[model samples]
Target: MAKKAVCIMSGGMDSTLAAYMLRAQGYEIVAVHFNYDQRTQQKELESFRAITARLGTGQTYEIDLDFFAAIGASALTDRSIDVPTGGIEAGVPVTYVPFRNGIFLSIAAAIAEKEGASVIGIGVVEEDSSGYPDCREAYIEAMQRAVNLGTRDETQLTIAMPLVHLKKEQIVAEALAYDVPLELTWSCYSDEAAACGVCDSCRLRLKGFELAGIPDPIPYRVKNGVS
Candidate 1:
């Protein structure tokens, strides 16, 4: 039997690519997506559903953690804050959803433990997020420590961040190499039908695919309300 892995699939480029990498490594992929009161949560989950079904993953799990609203100050959960443009060069941006990864990882780790999975997969890219310390190697390592110590299982929980050190362009190249369906993933911070290219997440995604010389399969509404 193939070793089991629980992939935290957010239906973004990085996480989708991470799933491909793990599948390439011969792990029985079990995708787990969260609906944590995020504005784009529903659309993102839909993307995951499509991608996982296309890939024929063993099973896909969807969990709703509505409790995240109580811990919400970030732009993703709270509508008051605007998603940042440019990058988050100025410390952590409003888009940095306040320990969001930590929350996701903790929940994923729990589910992995229940499923008898020793490895938990998350796709946090360092190059894509320069300002978020949570995406850094040090932070991931610390989280791993917490998971290990906090878990009751004898088997250690290993956090797998395959794209952690790669740039967005490199990630795109990797995704293409693995033949991942990029169109099935969504990365826009906006809740609209099409991506708002001006937002930080959309801009970075546009730049990544452009730099990698690949056509972005996801449709985008033209900037300034022009289709």
Candidate 2:
């Protein structure tokens, strides 16, 4: 039987590329997406479905956690905390969903155990990220240990973070090399209709494309001098 990998896809370029890489390594993919009442929930779900179709993977899961909205800590989940559009700041931004990756990995661990999968792939880019504590490699590694300790004795799982140390430019180059459908992915922290070019997410993405010498395919509300 072919080895299976449960990929935690967020419908962004990074996650999509990670899933594609896993598939390239000869693992049957089990794509998983979480909808935690984020600002761009609909857009993300649409992208996830399109990515799954492009991958031609039959097994997929879309889990909704409404508690995020109730908790209301992060800018993505709370309406009051405006998403920073000025630029990438010095510390953990308001957009950092509280303990989001940890929660997602925990659920992915359960899915991996149920599916008898050996690997769980998550797209976490720490080098160019917004300093979210949950995106740190050490935290993820600790989570992996805790997950294994909590799971059945026979079930062993490795949490794969392919983009942990890569910068956004490198990720863009890698995604292009893999022929990932970049146009289908969404990275805007605010505004679902068109990307707000000033947001941290958009800035990083545009910078990546610029550094890669590749024009971004998605439309942005403000160009902000990004070619």
TM-score attained by model 1: 0.93
The per-model lDDT (C-alpha) reads 0.83, 0.91
- Tens digits of per-residue lDDT for model 2, 68-116: 9999989999999999888888998999998899999999999999999
Q: Which candidate number has the best lDDT?
A: 2
lDDT of 2 at 196: 82
Worst 10 residues of 2 by lDDT: 218-227
lDDT of 2 at 55: 93
The TM-score, computed over Cα atoms with residue i paired to residue i, of candidate 2 is: 0.97
Per residue, candidate 1 scores C-alpha lDDT tens digits across 1-227 of: 56888899998889999888988888888899988888788789889999899777877899888877787788888877777655445577777777778988998888888888878889998767847778887899999999999988585988999998888889889998999999888998875588776677887787788889887888887442345
Pick the TM-score winner. 2
